[model samples]
Target: MSATQFFKISLKRSTIGLAPDYRAAARTLGLHRSHQTVYRPADSTTAGLILKLKELVKVENVASIPTSVEINAARKAARGYQVVEKQGAFTKI
Candidate 1:
């Protein structure tokens, strides 16, 4: 049989102060931040994890290993501002 394919699932939100079950699921998947990724074989366990944290996690198909490229790209896309300007002017000494 061919090598097992893995899915790269990320936690898109924090479980802090949320439902206990949701937080437990996130912890089980090793997700503790807004951009945490977990690699799991395409199996029932992984599917269960997805279902458990569906509201706080986002699942996507991945070829091999998990990478930050996809997550970073998503972050940039969701950003409302490209550059933040300072309110005050700079001074010289």
Candidate 2:
């Protein structure tokens, strides 16, 4: 399979007090909340939006799209121990 080049943008600031145009640009770019992230194809429209909201976001280049499962797995906390009593009923304390 081939990988597509895209921009991974994370909103670093809130747009509440910004100009309406600036906020619109951020909305168009799929960024509506601080710390929220979205991926866009590497193209002029995306570039223009990024430039328009440059001060409110952080950008990075990502080479491939990860599956939803992968994304979900990445966000899950790691378990420190294995469950060895799966077949047993819970014991009363």
Candidate 3:
């Protein structure tokens, strides 16, 4: 089977003071707040919506959708840790 593709859209601008139709298009694109990212199937209908809100969002092609767990992991801060000494080298201050 052929692999499916999707579009990763990020809201780069605000919707305030914009036309109602444009705002509606943003909502239809599943964008709720500024800087939010969403994925949609790569199709003509989605393309049309992206075109309508081209000025407010950024779009890119992605091979597949990431799971919620993966997305959360990607957004999480990295843990900084180091083993200065091995277990045999226990010391008291």
> Pick by lDDT: which candidate is best?
3
Ranking by lDDT: 3, 2, 1
Enumerate clash totals for all models, in the order shown: 0, 0, 0
After superposition, which runs of candidate 2 have C-alpha atoms over 4 Å from their true positions? 1-4, 81-93
**Model 3, span 1-93: residue lDDT tens:** 126589999999999999999999999999989999999999999999999999899998888999999999998988998888777765998
Candidate 1, superposed: residue stretches over 4 Å from native: 1-4, 66-93
Superior by TM-score: candidate 2 or candidate 3: 3
Whole-model lDDT values for every prediction: 0.77, 0.89, 0.92
True lDDT of residue 19, candidate 3: 90
TM-score of each: 0.61, 0.77, 0.78
Better of 1 and 3 by lDDT: 3
Worst window of 10 by summed lDDT in candidate 1? 77-86
Q: Which stretches of candidate 3 lie over 4 Å from their true place?
A: 1-4, 82-93
Ten consecutive residues with minimal summed lDDT in candidate 3? 1-10
Per-residue alpha-carbon lDDT of model 1 for 3-89, expressed as tens digits? 657777889888888888888878877787888778877788878978977887888776687357965676675647666766777
